[model samples]
Target: MMEDFSGLALPPLFGGHILETELDAAGVELTAGTTEILESGGTPQDIQKDTRELDKRKYQALSKRVKELEQVNERMLARLHRVQRLTRRLKKERRFLMKTLDTYGDDYRNAEITIPLEDEGGANLDGIPGGDDGGSSPSTTNQPACGPKKKRHRVPKEKERDAQ
Candidate 1:
């Protein structure tokens, strides 16, 4: 019976010739020294209470990590949604522009960036400005304005409104 340890699948019931239930501590996370256990009276309940406390601490740390990852995931999802919306809008705009170019390709290719020179006396095609009311800025002498011909007001996006 003493030489039959291979059948039990352990490296023999090793002990100091007195204790046979002692296990090797190869895979143990912590090994409380013999004197340390004796100082705590070696009570099983105390050992169990310590193990529970350790597990609770590990659980709390893992829970906090999971919450942080969840917040990051939410931010990533919102950014992804915003990117998808912008991509869709860009694709639609590109397709519309391509269609418009196909219809008026030659016109765009040949057209120069020149605003119809305001009437010499500042009288527009509408026959409306004789002199004082209709005035073109000296800064806008020749080159076309970068923006719209009229003072167009734009409705701001929600984010831009908040920023403002």
Candidate 2:
């Protein structure tokens, strides 16, 4: 792994690179994590023979750590986006529920369809099925719309048993 002392183009390990921070010990805050190809001509094997094993282990550990951090950060970013969307959905649902309560008052009971055609207060909070323009008051209505009872079709016992 060597040529006769011709410098800058040959090294113990061909195409050797050193971490930038290792090259410049001072003012390395800006150049950390960058690599610089070796240019020094001395036999790097002879100069730093003893530390190669240690450096190899450190490189493997650092590479694994970088991959691990990248995966965890990616998952966290995905979860953050999901949480943001959920927060927006919840806010919109809350606005809808609040508007429903304000327009109709606390008139609902166990999901009943008995919407009041008139209330004592002036606000016409009738949730009229098709005629609701969302701007009508109680005085605008000529007749009260009584919610019709839901018609239930009873399936025959023989059909129910067959479905089961």
Candidate 3:
């Protein structure tokens, strides 16, 4: 009858045994049985293949993520460039405005403007009071520039109203 060797500890090469002396003492009989089971199961080779496949999938996913990040970086760089260009343009415009103000600001503020009068039926200032034609002063005029003042009617106090 064949003994059940399934529960027996495996050798160090198969990731089971802890001691080298135990592995060496296990001898050819146990090694042969273990080899037979390993060959039939194809476990080690399958595990290596599966690990390689998983590594390939992980590498592909990482590569895809890298590409996405690179695209985002490129877009951010483009937006940054646009902002920088606008900033440069605004700075240039500000400089130009400052230069213009430095050159002509005082002149514009202190310049006096005179309008020549046309003689074509415009209002005659000669007949008006306080005119340059040497008319009477504004105070000597009978009527004031504003209308005459009106007299105010005062309201009675509370005690005066009760007495009335």
lDDT of 2 by residue, 91-163 (tens): 9998898789879876544565756653344443555455445554567554446755679998679878999
Local accuracy of candidate 3 as per-residue lDDT tens digits, 1-164 = 44554653332223432233333443323344444655676678775665565446545554654576578678889989999999999999988887897786555546698765534344454555443443446675677768889899999999999999
Question: TM-scores for all candidates?
Answer: 0.43, 0.36, 0.39
- Which lDDT tens digits does candidate 1 get at residues 1-164? 44554433224234224211322222222245333544686578886776666556545554654576578678889989999999999999988887889887556656679677655554465555455445656776565758658777998999998998
lDDT over C-alpha atoms for residue 37 of model 2: 15
- Model 3: CA > 4 A from native: 1-41, 106-164
lDDT of 3 at 45: 76
Ten contiguous residues with the weakest lDDT in model 1: 18-27
Of 1 and 2, which scores higher on TM-score?
1
lDDT of each: 0.59, 0.55, 0.59
Where in model 1 is the C-alpha error above 4 Å?
A: 1-41, 107-164
TM-score of 3: 0.39
